[model samples]
Target: MRSSMTIVHAPQSDIKMIPSPILTQVESFQHWKNDIIRDIARYRAWLRDNVIYDQRVDKELQLIQARLRDKTLSIAFVGEFSRGKSELINALLFPQSEQRLLPSTLGRTTMCPTELIYEQCSEPYLKLLPIETRQEALPLKHLKQQEDRWLHIPLDINDSKELQNTLSHIGDTKKITVEEAELLGFDCQFLESSSDAHVYVPTWRHALINIDHPLLRQGIRILDTPGLNALGCEPDLTFNLLPDCQAIVFLLNVDSGVTATDMQIWRDHIGQLQDRSATNLFAILNKIDLLWDDFADDEEIKQSVKKMKTLTAQQLNLEESAIFTLSAKQGLHARIKGDEDLLKKSNIAQFETLMFESLIDKKEQSLRKNAIEKTIFLLGNTKATLQAQLKQLEADNRSVIAMLNQGHGEMKSIAQQAKRDQVVYQNQIIALKASKQAIAKQVNTLLLSVNQDHFSTYLETTRTNFKESWSSIGIRESIAHFFTCLESDFTHLEIETNTTIKIVWSIYDKVLANSKLTHNANDDNHPDNTDSNIDKNIDRNIDRNIDRNIGNTIDSNIDNDINNNWDSHSSEQEHDLDLVQPTEFRIFEFNHSLAGLKTKATQYQKSFRSLLSGQRKSTHHFFNSVAAEAQQIHQAAHVEAKAWADGLLIPLIQHATSRKLLLDQKVKVFKALAETNKSQRQKQQELVQFQASIQLQFEDINLMIQSVSQKRPQQSFYESLKLKSTPISSEPQVY
Candidate 1:
């Protein structure tokens, strides 16, 4: 059995033993374990500081922890208007129910955030609380006002009945009325009193709901977002709440793969938060059932799907495979029929699998294993290399100790020579200091003779020159040029407005003519003996009214017309007009000031010159005093330089010399260690090769032993005797 095992032998020349396989394996295991422990500690600290200790992040962490404990995962359904987001949710969760949370009509829905959670209880209660300034709750009625507040309402019903009733009030497709706005507590005056009166008030119902559903009970929460208009209208709800979702399933109609409105929503809201690693975003090309008509073949549908996927990927900066095509309507039908095979045939099943794998399963596995593997690989190699180097360093240190002792005496002699050189430089520094002091004293005396007040007087003369320059240029003409430019712009605007009014009035006349003929004639017959003059007068009045209305319409559009004209005219006029020319005036002022200052400067120079001529003897006396002070300064500097040379420079030079000696010794030691390391590494390599050979030989012998053991029953007595005799003759191999 032992002979069957592979054995590796060391080379005859290689006395060093490389570690055994068991030891190598243990070392690898230890390295891996140590690195794991370190990484865990590091991650623990980071998690504590960033995720746990920080108040804002702590809440998120706590929520994550709670969700994990509850085995719940949240999927946010988000996109622009009419993207089939709510339809997708219904298809996934409650296909059988006739009621829906979405507003299918041509009006905005989902006014505020709504959360769907699981409740085991049968009787659902509706709880309403108004939004408040702080955490304190307010009355639900308060939300009716035009305040920056929200409301929370819990409805009462076991099924979807209560939800249907509550949402019905806000789900009407008709134009919003003043009465509805008053009931919703919205300020209607802004919409009702405008000259172009238009009512588009948002729905009143806004709350989080807890429903008893199989999906919710299975630990899945869904957020069916409102249309683009509603979300854009209330940006705060979208930005603050949508980003926190674990995953977003963006639904897009397959018929209209991507639209301008979708791009607008993406740019304004989703784009900013798309880069986060924690947020898992997916795109759904929904309503594929619409494409399954007779006109389009399977291949055409496939190509269309591919094109949409590519376009979406390019727009969103994501992988093409991430965007999926599915039919929510088909999925709903498949689910209700209990046809697993049919469900698998649909794209919705593929999307479901993708969501489960990418968002839930794969994400959890990546978070666990990725860092662990990276840390193990990195630290394992590092520890092995460091251990090898450390071993060589220990042997080299012994040689370095001996070399340092040998170089000690020579280092001291070299240091002494450096100190002697430092002394010579110190004497030179003293002479330079004396020369510098003498020059400084002469410069100070030269400065003291000049008067600064004369310079200010000269600057005043420059101001007078600037005033004369302005008079020569004629300021009135410059002002007239500016007014001329202004009048031209105003005239251009008026002309453009008049042209636009003429065109608009022509269109208005045609519209009025058509409208007058279309008016019902039945009211005329019902009138009891109406005066003919009165009817004629009314017709004239109507004509006059139409003219006035058309006039007002032209007036309303005048600003836009003028602005467009200004944009075109300004571009052309910008090159022609350089009216102000302020730069020219500034330059004239600067040059004049400098010219005036020159006269005062010259007078001051003359006064200094005359003083020097009369007081030469006194100047000589001052020079002598200055020279004496310079001599004293020179002496003090000489002493300071000498002290620096002796105390600082000499020691520094000595230290540098000693460092060089130490370095030379270290180099010699390193050379010896290199030779030793080279020899050891060679020995280890040879041992490893020999061990591999032995292992191969051992494996061969094991095969022979197994064959012999198996053939023992079939062998004759003579054959057995021969086999036993063969081992006796090869007794030296046992060694």
Candidate 2:
């Protein structure tokens, strides 16, 4: 793939340098997002100039802009303690430093799950959440918003030693009694005993590291997790946080192979993440340098490493291509000393290239669908408006030409024909009003299906069931029953929305058909057989002319894309010819979030103790978080349904009403021409001039729609795997 960085060799290095593949792709992705934002802004300006912008469209576009600006590409590193997760993070992000940025000591350096991120407003610091907060009933997300609950430590970015010393505070521990550990939400059976009565536990529950690093400033976030014991105790880490990340890198120790504890961590935490299709999973056999020996040749060592990869993949039930053997220590050493040969042998570069290929494409596709799809719908609205106006102008010019050939008595007959056309427009407007009421009644039923009261009742029933039985079987049954009823509600909402759309579109089709009949009658009465027809022959094929010129306007001036970007599976986009793309109302895609919770619920059921107090704490921890998330999802779905109903029904009625007013204005102009002594030449010239202006405006609208709807081109994967001696400078701030 093409990168934004260039190679620069050191003084003593034998070969030229290569940049980091992941960083290169990240730079390219940031540029691609900026292009999408710019296109949306231009589309909004076009709407305002065309007199079609409204309050609803303005609010929706603002939300989309906010989502693109705040976007972050997050990755999580998960494994048990002593698996080299911390070491791998240090090697990947801080290769140029003289020492490891994060302390990777002999054992359990990262005692809690720590996140590394960059915020422009904040100075360099470490924020720690105390372990005592585990006794509360609030979820982690709510706790994070309260600044007073965390302890903060400041750091100097220029001093590497000071930063390293401050980061080692994450591994600090406290000695507490076994009874005290249980009271603080830790299972006493899993703690390491310092004495007969006391055991060791982590002093903090979570850590947040904010610093000005090159990759972190580009919106690259990293999460370093603790061991199996911590994962079993925290439902927020497994359910709310880990499942939301875009990619996960799970590491294993090569010398120990896949032990029983390693299998427990995989089955309980990392493996369940595969249910979320958006998350990418990969396994690393770290600390491979321990297998190297001087007695064996290079070919023999290669065979041994290949054998380990095959066995590890089979044991984890993953493909061999997803597993790699690498020594984090060797990779860090090679990058610091500018040794290209040692870095190639370490195999870290190969792993990074594959990660870049898998992540960048998926992130780009997701941003396009979320941010650009709505812009395309708005563009379709503008296209339909312009095309309708062009058709009306053509019909009006035909009437003026026929009036020039008539006597005084024939002019009187022509005025009566205009009166008949007004009646046809009036009947169609009445039909649209009746359809509006029918759609409003159906929309209310769809909203009621997803109301908060229904979801609240379901939550209450699940809580009661757990309180009565307090058993593991009760927990499993309650969670399964809760999601089943919620799924039924969504199914009902989908069925109701489709039925409403079909009925409304049928009414709109009848109105269009009636309007066409009125235009054809006007054409038959006003046949332009005089020499004036020859003057208008140059502009006869107005529609085809606009299409040809629009291709050039979009390619040279706008986003250089012309094909339709709306979903092909949408029934409205398929059947409607007027480019009304919003007829197909989409509910939220909540399936991935629901499936991730179900997997975590199953794990929670298995890990609970038999005691009544322990069961109470576990139930409180799991259900409180689930209830809060469900409320937000249900409320959002209701609001979106309301917006879609208004968007689909209101604009259609307004369009029909405005067309009737246009017909009235044309009748008045014809009556004035029949009575007054105005010159026939002056009237004909005015009609012809108005028709030309309508044609130009129609072409401009078509070009603007194409500029916003085109999909962006993707870059090819990079074949070479290598890194520079030093990291490149950070990218410009996107927001």
Error of 2 at 681 (Å): 12
Clashing pairs in 2: 1-717, 1-718
Candidate 1 local lDDT, 1-735, one digit each (tens): 000111112233423322112222223323333443443444335435322222322332333333223434677877776676755676555332323433343334444345666657633433222321212222222342533454434565443454555544333222455544333333344332324454554443345466665556655667766554444222233333454456777778877877876765565445555654556777787777776766667676677767777888798776655677777666655655545554555566546644643445323433333333333322232233223323333443433344444643232222222222222222222222222332233223322222223223333443333334333233223323322332333344334334433332232232223233323221343243223433443354445445543454335564564455444442323210111110000122222322322222222223222212323222222222222222232333333222222221121122222223333333343334334534444533433443353344334334332332221111133244342124211111100
What's the lDDT for candidate 1?
A: 0.40
Query: How high a TM-score does candidate 1 get?
Result: 0.37
Clashes of 1: 8
TM-score of each: 0.37, 0.77
lDDT for 550 in candidate 2 is 35
Best by TM-score: 2
* Cα lDDT of model 2 by residue, 1-735, tens digit: 010111211335454343556676677677766766776687677557655566667677777777667558788888888888887887777443334567676667787889999989999899999987876788888988998999999977666566656787888778889767776667767677884679888888899999877778888888999886554467677666787678888889877778887887787667777766577777888877786677767677666667777898788877676777787777766666667777776777767666655566556566666666766666566556556756765775676576574632244345545555554455455545544654566778888888888998998898788778656666667878988888788888888777656555544554455446544544564455332442243133222223332332223322212111112224343222354434456574654455556667666556546223435665677667666666666677777778777777445543444444555555566566667666777666656765675566667756755665554443342322211122211111100
